[model samples]
Target: MGRQSILIVEDEVIIAMELRETLEHLGYMVVGSELRGEDAVRSAGKLRPDVVLMDIHLKGEIDGIEASDRIARSYDIPVIYMTAHSDQETLSRAIRTQPYGYIIKPFNERDLYSNIEMALHKHRVKSRMDGSPEMVDSAINMIAGAMVITDPQGHIERLNLEAEQLTGYQLSDVEGAPFFTAFGVSVPGRDLLIEKLLVSSEYGAGSMISFPSTIQIRMKSGGDLLAHLSTALIQEKESLQIQNIACLIEPCAPDTEGRAGGYQGAAALVQAIPDPFACVTEDGGVLLYNDQFSSLCERLGDGISGVALPINRVLPESFIGSLAFFHEILVDNQVVTREKMVKYSTGSIVYTIRYLPVGGDTGGSSRCVALHIRDVTAETLAMHHCERAQGESQNTDAAVEGIGDLCTALKEKVLAMSTAYEQGLAFHDTAHERLAEVNRILGDIDLRLIEIEKNRWV
Candidate 1:
């Protein structure tokens, strides 16, 4: 091998140039560079490089996944995917292409170099296998999920990178160990289940079984991971005997909340929120939640032991009644809001419930919903006070208007009295009685005006 050659396929010009320089510095020959998936496929066939570094999202009718598929089928070249997206859907699609390695973007030079060498080595090993069952080892390493392969006696033969990370145990430490002991599988009838699976495999090749219940994997770091267990028996074609037992372990819940130490950073972020926050699955299962959420559940008289329980089991009945709203948010992928008042023996508390859809395409089904509960009792009470004050202000304005009208009527009466006095002077004897009556009426009017003014202020 004179020098290993690599091809770069990326949409970003700057990133492509930087990757090329890095590869050159790492002593690998840069065969060619392409921006579009179509061009990358063409170049891969022509250049026939040792490894093709392909980006998942490229600028063309075909994405890097399709291009890699075409290259693998046409040229049998190993392609190592370079991507920034780590979503389940994207990973599933890329894994289907059977790439030699998958490296996330913004990686250091050591990561790039190591992945490149590993891809080359795995590709060479696969080629040397020449259609042997051991070729399955390379395929297993490429999978995105945790996997473990055991011998016919159920002793661990090999485990994948994801399995090592999930269990916090290396292959050197767990090789030849019993599967259950190595994984710390906690099931009531686990021994019987394994015996049945082994006995059933004697009947024929390709015997497989899926564990129905959830499995709790005890990690090396003294933590437990809740996962779903699936196993398939691999038999020799000629011997028709059980050769190996392949076990695929998947999280019992969604990635947002599953795995013991998988989402520590996200968990910290959730814990930082002052309000009660939780990520609830579509089926009302609690994934990630903060301590505030736990306290809220306790306050509601539903104390939960751990985060693995269903949200309905611990939340208030009012929240359970909002199942329709939760379904709507998951279906429509929209934010919804409602208010609920929980009355305890002591007092009542008001909460503004917000449901926001998370991790799904627009107009598509949501993976889960984030539940944020805000204490808005004080805000609600302040709003009520402001509304009452406005009502009182309106009433005061109406009273002042009435007082102004009364004053105008009093002035008119005074003007009429003046005219009567003038008439009394004209007809001295005739107007004398009228003047006396006017004087009494004027005194009554003066007393009534004073009373009205005093009442208006009060």
Candidate 2:
């Protein structure tokens, strides 16, 4: 109807006549219908169609699939596949042809028309969707889903790149086969579903259970396959109608709730993550507390849940006094911060208490006391440990140097004794004095070690 001419390359005479009649009824002009692959290839030179319907199991040396490929490559026309055999190997070959969709054999006029219409519609939709700014839409066309467009009769009218790849039917081989044949085994209660759709609104949709079967297909050439599948409905215009369909099958984090959902512009870049974080309100209240807060209490052996709901119930005694200073910030609606060492039952933990006050017409709203309590205890300990390590390293280096000096002095003393033995002079007091100094240095170092152990809790 829209100047889209179709070329039908079907071997069967009755099937070819039916195809031409269907094409005419659907408002598509048929350029040619050839019974053999060689004749179809020759017809391509005489009559050009917007699309070719190529059957996989066609007559003669050049099969319909191969002939379509040659015509498509040389003349640049799109092709649809028709086939009775939905075997894996034949379908694989059909997909390589990139036909629009397959119409199964023994198909009715409605089924044939639906296939042609759906293929044309999908081609149009692809062009329209690509005009959008989103790259995601284009990516959808490439995903591994069987894209079947069903008419009001539940007949497949259209299919896309993925459907061609999945079913293994050449568009020409099965253009008229019932859609049920494409599905092989029947769906349970499907007849009931069709009845419900007749009673329901046009946009109404539902799912039906399909059979559990794997097909080992044997083409005339003998190819086999076993595929698992289910069926769903999409009655609305261009509606996304399927089970287990991911619109975007790529890496993207979807925020369905919270501040993350509200984050616009730059906020999307700097939101608090899953671990321990704080959100300070304007007036004065701890709006949210997460798993890390509970963990902090567990380490302290205290059941800490309620104190901060309005505020933390089990807050450390040190933090309680800081709260008064924080209250003043709320009164003045000003921000104030205090870092304190919070004591648990076992030991003390350090926290940097940051306060952000909410200012209103009169004063602090009282709803806005955003206490950003960070557990800086680990960081503080790490810094202290690093300092102690460097200090010990320096001390050890000094001690080793002292030991080396002691060794050198002792060797010199032995030489002095040998010289005294030869010259009959005294080498006595110098050796004793050197040994005494070495012992004193060692005793001083041992006392320092004891002092370090005394302050071990830090």
Candidate 3:
């Protein structure tokens, strides 16, 4: 393959020149350089470079994060952020953009090369996987429970953020490491079960194995975690050979049976709701959801077959922003309501989501939050129509009032002219009668106008 091409986007001229020199020295083709975010976006479209080295601060209206988001969504280009600041707020915004890699400023040649190569490799892998690896990654990270994906031999390929938190091992530390060794599992017949599942998957006999009971997990922090473990084999489409094993680990409370019974009762109660309703833990895990919620998930292209999954995984991302205030609901014992406009291929939908604290002390910690979603599309549309109609009616009334004023002025002028004609004409008697008739006609017309205005609604 030819040398990978890169674009440098930095406002500082000195840093931009130094970056170009380093990239060229590392045997990379520097396609273009820009000092502003807007220029960088235009250059990305024109040059179509393999990777972009973006600086967080830029000299234009938009910053690097915004520019990178536009480029990724519009051109599907990979961006690696290079910044001097390491503040949490900056990092959080950058992570939302989903940059391929992030390198702090004053990075070494080796660091630059590695980030570029990794970004290229990941982009290639995503393309090979039908261009949805980013989506899959987002979905995985959105999951409330810890999840790990490993090769058939049990070597780790990738794991989500929750998994990293649970295992206390980052992806960089455990990539290609044996899963069983990295995080110890204390389930009986765990090895035998994995071997059997692998063998069955290889021969196309079975593709999944789920453990219903809770198992003990030896945490990296030297604490024990009780979790429900389930695994499924991801197979190659045509070959039917196992490519990877997906392990879903949901942490459970010690009172598992009692919690299960409570969930069952809650589920029965929520089933009576006509709208989409769900009860989620404070940590965003679904404890119980009604069928309408499940159907809504399916319609939104996120189908949920079990509880304990993350609410983010089951709902659209646009709607998840409101749930971020779940803690506030718990603490204040207040019902938080938000409305979101979701556009579908067929039409737009307006949903009102209400978050209420469920059985928690006032101004104290809460265990669960009830999420109720109502389809308010029709109601919203009707309200808009009503407002529009009222506005038009007001406009019409104003126009009618103006015409009424004009008619009254014209009537008074005609009456004054008739009185003068009746007084000055030689045949004053006949003219007086004619003027009387004209005045009466004008009065009749004014009365009719008043009646029309008064009965406008009718």
| Alpha-carbon lDDT, every model | 0.71, 0.51, 0.71
- Residue pairs with backbone atoms closer than 3 Å in model 1 (clashes): none
The per-residue C-alpha lDDT of model 2 at residue 358 equals: 30
Q: What tens digits encode model 1's per-residue C-alpha lDDT throughout 293-391?
A: 889988885776655677778986565445666778878765677899877788887889888776432233566788889888887887788797677
Model 3 sits at a Cα RMSD from the real structure of: 19.8
State the displacement of the C-alpha of residue 361, model 3, in Å, after optimal TM-score superposition. Answer: 8.3
Which candidate wins on TM-score?
Answer: 1
| Model 1: worst 10 consecutive residues (lDDT sum) | 203-212
- Model 2 Cα displacement at 328 (Å)? 87
lDDT tens digits by residue: candidate 3, 38-79: 989999999999999999888798999899989998999989
Q: Give residue 285's lDDT in candidate 3 (0 to 100).
A: 82
